[model samples]
Target: MASSLHIDLHKISKFVNLSIPALFVVFLSAGHFVSFYFHFFTVAFLFMVIANFFYMTVQKEHVILKNFGLMGQARYIIESIGPEMRQYLFASDTEERPFNREERSEVYRKAKNIDSASSFGSQQNFDPSEIKIRHTMFPTPKEALQPFKITYGEERGLEFAYTITRPIMISAMSYGALGTNAVRSLARGAKLANIPMNTGEGGYPEYHLMEDCDLIFQIGTAKFGVRTDDGLLDDTKLAEIASKPQIRMIEIKFSQGAKPGKGGLLPKEKITDEIAKLRGIKKGADVVSPPYHPECDTVEKTVAFIKRVQNVSGLPTGFKICLGKVSEFEVLVEEMKRQDVYPDFITVDGAEGGTGAAPKAFLDGVGLPLLVGLASIQDCLKRHGIRNKMKLNASGKLISPRAQLVAFALGADAIYSARGFMLSLGCIQALQCGNNTCPIGITTHDPELQKGLVIESRAPRIANYVHNIEHDLEELLRATGCKSFSELTEENLYIPSDTVLGNYRLNSPEVQAAAS
Candidate 1:
């Protein structure tokens, strides 16, 4: 009985599949009798359908096309627009994934210089496992907030040094990784905010210097901006970059949060003549920076290189890294102690960091998230008795006041944010950055897309966004009985005891071994 029913169903399915083509044929024949235009369109459409049908049936590669015929193609169309559908139409504001609607909306509002306050009640679940800020019974007096600052590498036995006036600075987003207009807007914004902007692995571009903003020149493994013909650090190039009065500090790229071990990867399509000239590399191909610095393979060499760059540039220099093995950091600090040298600061990137492009495995599984990485790095630095010698910068989704405050509580002296600033520049989080077609021009080099971003206009939005964050941070500080950021500590932030710290098993003995 089941077999007969199955046969009947199969026959019906075949008839339905065959009926579609039969109907098209009927339409084609009817159209021929009706009008020339009708007939022509029918003929063209029929040919396309027939070709698709033939390909579907004859091609054995895709089982869906072979088994389900023409209807199977619908799946591909739907899959292509799945992310868009989910992002714009279906997903709720609170649903957390890659920067939920709420997060994006907050940035958007702030960037637009609109009110970010929500009325009625809180959207967050006040669950025990959730993180909570410690509010004192006696709050500090609320007053007009002032722009905050943190000085590093100043009077620290360096010929030239830096005093970062803003607690938040722009994180590394390279010239090749971002469009010229985007870089210009960010530079302008940084100037407006009186903050510094870090140029990523890609060489520094002139647009970054156009606004007279302080710049932190980053030396990636590829050493693009300051590299010699042989791809080694060129003293002349270093001096040239240092000579730029706007260039304030230097950062040695070890690893970012997005792809800890996988170095910078700029798609071939993004490589333009300007980018090539700036980076001193040939254009028209993807640029994959090496995973590790050639000049500093070991901790000792890394420390020596930092000192060398500091000496040469006569500026504050530091290294950026995503937390990997705790022992590696410990070893690095040990080397720093032995050499009596250290980078002016260390940027600890959380695994949640954004990237222009990265492999899925590296993006999701490679390094520790911001809080854990920040804690571990802080612990390691303190353990080696060198935490006070250098400032610690934290990145990776440290966009919100709560996140930033938490970071300070965890021992971050300053914060760096990429996606947050991108949002300010009108990034809708399309996640198409890896490709050359970022819809809003935040990551694209295409002239047409870039035209949508006007530097003079978007720069203000970036400043507004930064101002909003700082303002909110001041409020939080006042409520927490802290007169200033310097008074913040881990005791000011609280996480539930039962909270599970992802797959790291952070509470486990092995993971917490380095924790103080």
Candidate 2:
């Protein structure tokens, strides 16, 4: 009997850490003419102790929870908020993960029309092996330079072909992926900046066309906006969409940077009633776009599809893709040349590009970075002697003037950014985009959160960001002594390595000879 009692006491002592606190609370409540607060506190602590016992014995998922009991909850609590704590407390300005503090700060400052000049000294380590653009001692005379603009589909000879007023346009960000206010603000802001806004693969909603912004309507693999009930392309619906005057170009999205070879995902939580209606999907269901285009299954079919859309729409047509099987693009270019067909433009999305949501495998390891991918695509097209037929738009982390300049030197005819504009609209880089609870209302559907983003106010910031970036771009072009982007060349830019870099340009005699 004595031994059994000692054993029972030992087990009880093991939980004394929790029991002591509960006993103290209960003692206080019983000793005093208990206030309502004390009663509630005592009850809560007792409930927790009982719950902790059940969790310790029954919970099998985590060993710590079973072994350490309630105290182990600290691990999960700390883990849940770890990202937030690190971002605010520990991350350095130049620590580039998604977007570094410095990058986001610059966008925010420029958007707000605040002084964005850097002070003191540079934060970056001047690595000798880094690629740098050559700025001539004598810059081009600003008085003789023309305003920023670029035209697509000049070779295609279409009446409604796009003549973009600015090289920096809003990249494709779908209505379903973003909040209603975000889409509307982007539309209004693009109108103010006189720049084009892409309607991402989700589909075109009325908000996209609400402000007379030039829109590049994108047809994704699922063909959401223009699909028939059977999930096939409906030419009648496509024609009707194309009839809109504000719709200047049509893009067939083959893949995006963040999730190349992966489909677009709108978690069930994000599929609001309006989104379901716009995308023509059932509400409260996960919206997953197909990984591949249903219509463009082969290279020949893809070219034919582009021509079909162009013919039906009477607008410049193109495709957007990230770097994949290199030989695939080679085959695509070859087929286009052989068939005497060409897209109006090709948008090369870098792997570092932003997405609303994607798997870790696709996001981190799937595609080529923007620099390599853009150069490769450019080289492939140029080698085939068909580069002149189409424009090349580069999309990735082109928030900075230097990044844009590097892209232009690598053969980008234009640049676009989605996340940069989101920053302009007051994104704090909370990294909660995948969840439907974006605190800033940019990517959330919560009415209260959406109210925080006032379109009338943020629209000006968007316009300002666009203006400032273009101004900075012009400054860089002037420094390089280039009259326009057309005057920029690979020779003007230098890679810092002594070893000869693998030239992406394939039209050179040596490359042609090697290929033959």
Candidate 3:
């Protein structure tokens, strides 16, 4: 009887188990569509019936497991259901601890324009730190004020100085990994918020222009996005893109949080003709960027090239990177000290971020956490006495007020978020981004797969999320008694006292880098 039951269940699944009611629930709840719902159900039932019929006849489980193994089968069967499992087990409500659950909820509430005030009183479990918290004077704040503009270079001149219109902006995640609608929606949202969006190493995208969004185009190691006839950065090519009103900043990518000092990869399967053309590589072949740039090999040359980009573009240009050896940063700062050429800004990205696809070793081992890296860069500037010469921005997992505030307190002029924005656009963190099979349609080229993303609708949500976060950030700044984000100092914030006494202290820079 048990054997018969298993056989029947298998048959049912193979044939018309989609008749199982859940499939039609969305349709039924969608409208007063009693007839249409029934029609869909009937059609679905027939489809499942045929499917089950084949399944019963074939009965190939043993064959599948033998040929594909558990891992392979999991990809299709168990993994296909991974999203459902995560939603049911986890929540939009449960806090992510350490950096856990309730914390994420507060941010989501503020971003969604819902009440962020906790009901069961404050969620904090602060154990009374040894360090006393500090408050500020002139608590009332206004929008659109001074020093809110991020200044990068004084010696190099004002043209190189840049502004971060809002503390919250979109960080880099290339277009190839994120679909057309996703890019469009994000750009539209950034335009509405008057913040900048960093186009990942994928280069300048046309969809970014369509939305009239301000942008920071990233230059990867291979110089993939903007290239000369020899596939290097072309002045004309840079100018053509820079001439547009929306294009705002440029960054030369040396390394990232997920995999610093590693080469880039676009699997052979993803090397579409269009992507190949945009990146100036060939299609159907695995695309890899050299481990380093051919031109900017030395620290001095890197700074020189940065100036070349800024000189030609007439817009802010800088570098987005993870802090590694102090010696290398010291060398680069030494070059800046000698040459008087400064990048418009420096974005300190943390190791907490993700990549399209990177080796497990690099992902786990390379780069520094955002806090350490940002603070290191800040200290470098401060110690070098050139702190005032460049704007410092923070990237990597910055979304909520606390995260933004932390960055601001740590001396970052602004913070940028990529995955968090992806979440606001309805990503459930399925972790399928690099595979070209994102169920959310944020990362794929297949037309059939792109149906899930609706640009016009999702675009507004993105805009709404950005607007809410920016306004709330202003509120937090006001509550802390600062007039502008630039004026916000470390005295306005607090951290766990133990964290200072612990491992963080060991990693702290021995000599502060001078900031002029």
Candidate 3 lowest-lDDT run of ten: 64-73
Best first by lDDT, ranked: 2, 1, 3
Please provide, for model 3 over 1-516, each residue's C-alpha lDDT reduced to its tens digit, 9 standing for 90 to 100: 466436553444333344434554555454345555566665664554455445445557655433333223445787778756766685444444223456555545554667766566655555664333356566664653443555444436655345555667788877887888889888987887778888888865766777888788888876775775455677787888777777777878878888888887667876777787777776667766777776788888888888788888877778888888767898899898798888768888888877667888987788888877877788778889988777787887776776777788788887888877887777655567777788788877667777878887677676777777777777777777777877776667665546642245445655222221
Candidate 1: stretches off by over 4 Å: 1-13, 24-45, 143-147, 155-159, 264-271, 283-288, 500-516
Please, what are the lDDT tens digits per residue for candidate 2 over residues 155-205?
Answer: 977787679778798999888678889999998999999999999977655
Q: Which one is best on TM-score?
A: 1
Weakest 10 consecutive residues of candidate 2 by summed lDDT: 498-507
| Prediction 1 global C-alpha lDDT | 0.82
Which TM-score value belongs to model 1?
0.91
Name the runs in model 2 displaced over 4 angstroms: 1-45, 264-273, 281-288, 498-516
Give the Å shift of residue 239 in candidate 1: 1.8
Question: For each candidate, what is the lDDT?
Answer: 0.82, 0.83, 0.71
Model 2 scores a TM of 0.90
What is the per-residue lDDT of model 1 for residues 1-516, given as tens digits with 9 covering 90 to 100?
Answer: 466435554465466578767767777777877755666667766775775678566688988667766666777899989888888788888895788888888889989989988999877766777777899997877663444677778538665667876678999998877888999999999999888998887785577888889899999888988887667788788988988899889898899889988866656765668778888877777766779888888778888988889888888888999988987888888888899998889999999999888889999999988887887787777777788788899999987888898888778889899889999999888878978799898798889999999998999998998889888888888888887787788678776666534333456444577685
Model 1, residue 198: distance off in Å is 0.8
| Residue 149 in model 1: lDDT | 70
